[model samples]
Target: MNSSVEKCHMFHESAVDLLTSIDFCESTLKTSIFFVAFNPIFWNIISRLEYYTHFLTKLTRNPRTGCYVLAVTIFSLGLVRNYFFEQALYKQGVTGVLQNEVAKVLGVALIIIGQVLVLTSMYQLGIIGTYCGDYFGILMKERVSAFPFNICENPMYRGSTLSFLGISLLQGKSAGLLITFFVHMVYEIALKFEEPFTMKIYRNPKKD
Candidate 1:
């Protein structure tokens, strides 16, 4: 127990040190972080609002169409966030520890694995499932429990977080790493809200 406590404490201190190395005040970095924080928050709020009000469904005149609209908006936002993250990486200082050839190789491997997980998840879920189609009253026939889902719960979120870390390492940027950490944190918080709400959605007797 003492050893576990010590390890946790050490990890916390190391994280603090890593964060201190980043330039939080830089415009690009701040913008990227804002989007990183904003994307999940925006999606969650919109999804829940749709659940409660069905305003999007009413606007589109169809559930699937509403989900598709949200999916396109989310996808476009992601592209913009990625662009800012790349721009921030260019402006940030490189960490010496991540400059080695081994880091580059590991980074490539991580990116490949992350993409596989993400792509496989998307393929399994489809666009509706990938986004918040269930919130639009369009749920899966049953719970998905294949391949990536069997191997990893919330595979898309996990895969995205891994990809962020992989890119940070590839770039050797402290700011990228810091932003990746924030991305992971935001996902975790989003999940806290998402999981229970998703369960509630599926609890309706109409589901297959």
Candidate 2:
């Protein structure tokens, strides 16, 4: 009876430790996710502000050059966001049994599909179109209704969300799953601001 009690005590302690570790990991993951979600929103707001103010153009002395600089800045921020996201994944504990061989395969497939949509959209848009050049008066001749775009209104955002979900599933990280939902929420909010502004730009040629 004493031995059984001792064994039960040990198991309880182990479970407590496991829970503590998971809590720590989740805290770190939330911080990482905040940065990932914030970066795009920050840049989008700043870029739109720049467009309205012409501060970037004044600083650069050329609208095209200013747009290019903003594009580079946005791209760099994206890289940083990805780094934080990866770090969060690393910190997360793999507690789910569903992260088996099948999960890994599904994750890889999702990543591939997401990349295809992203790359194809980029190709269709070119560097300027991909990076909000339209806001800077570098507008596309017309809307692109190609493979990815036709399939989804916002392929880039959807693809990115899918990639995040895929990675979370691949690693079987609960923290990652939560982060993915946060990512989707942030993108949805951004689109609410973005789509209307973009449509306004196109509708009023005077803005361009």
Candidate 3:
């Protein structure tokens, strides 16, 4: 259908426009993007190191305590990254098209859906499962296939991407959208390393 084709074309054009309109040189935006890329890399490297060396466990003298410490560190960094993102959004210019009432409603819906997916996944996994306790030789007895996981694989990453996009729309910031796209790209790369390695860990768990 011509109408359907036009809609698809328009959607692509709008995304391109939003991306192109971003101020890439903004310091705050750069910082936010850096953090976006950094978090996953940091965690993956640290988790893998922990898996091989048990440094955190040795340091804490308890597997659970080590995991909790890593979780706290990750959580704190996430908060800092979010704070920087908020600050960057303030510094960036707004997109006129995303300032409309429809955009606001859509943003609200995406945020709600994103939060539901994120929170529910966390609940299903618990703190140990939510974080990389598996790398610490602490893993769930079985796979989790419920709620958000049942609906989608990698719900946390998807939900996080949705949240970033939602907030970008809510703020009408084209820079936010650009940063969010990179956030997603980084996550996808992280997953490439993560999923296979995690599977290997589970398939041939460490022997005591």
Candidate 4:
């Protein structure tokens, strides 16, 4: 009974917040509805946790799969998060997020560069490469030796971080900045766990 009451209270509080931020929430709600209504069967087919985990394991067991999962989730959700945040900020009349025209320009430049770096990394890695195949014990045939790979070991992760920070700076939204910080935290955590595993995977390519 008490647990039920607590859940009710939380719902009530969230409703109140929604009421206060009606316009922003409405836009957010609409976007969510659209995505759900169009639920891409293709993504659902591939993005299942079970299949991804298996796929991640094949390439290397050193923890690359988990890190890949984290990266893909962050990149995909970051796009949604930033979109909602921008709408909220606009509705709230929060302007100072962009210090000035010059700042906005610089922010846009950063966003573009960051996006290119991120996409390049993703392309080089491919879907499973970006996500992970360890659950299936399926590893990439070989290491990626491409432009971005040569330029930086983890270009995608670094670019993604830059993209979020850039968007936050461009919009001058403190909320966006906070979310970006959270993202960075997740990535950092993944890095701590994944890097050593990756090194091991590279060092000892054959498990059997």
Candidate 3 weakest lDDT stretch, 10 residues: 14-23
State the lDDT of candidate 2 residue by residue for 66-127, as single tens digits.
88898898889888778877888787677544447997888888888888888888888888
* TM-scores for candidates 1 onward, in order: 0.88, 0.84, 0.91, 0.56
Candidate 3, backbone clash total: 0
- Maximum-TM-score candidate: 3
- lDDT by residue for model 4 over 1-208, one digit each (tens)? 9999999998887555433433434465345334322322223334344343444344446455544664566457655655665664454433342457886787788899888888998898876676645323456878888968888768876787678778866876544454456556666766675667656655664553
Worst 10 residues of 2 by lDDT: 17-26
Q: Tell me the number of clashing residue pairs for each predicted model.
A: 0, 0, 0, 20
- Ordered from best to worst lDDT, the candidate numbers read 3, 1, 2, 4
lDDT (0 to 1) per candidate: 0.89, 0.79, 0.90, 0.59
lDDT of 3 by residue, 1-208 (tens): 9999999999998877776667788888889988999899899999988998999999999999999999999999899889989999998877766878987788888889989999999999999998999998998999999899999999999998999989988888888888889989999999999999999999989843
What are the RMSDs of all candidates, in order?
Answer: 4.7, 6.4, 3.0, 12.0
- 27 Cα displacement, candidate 1 (Å): 0.4
Q: What TM-score would you give candidate 3 relative to the actual structure?
A: 0.91
> What is the per-residue lDDT of model 1 for residues 3-30, given as tens digits with 9 covering 90 to 100?
9999999888766656666787889999
**Residue 166 of model 2: what lDDT?**
85
Candidate 4 off by > 4 Å = 1-84, 91-97, 202-208
Q: In candidate 3, which residue pairs clash?
A: none
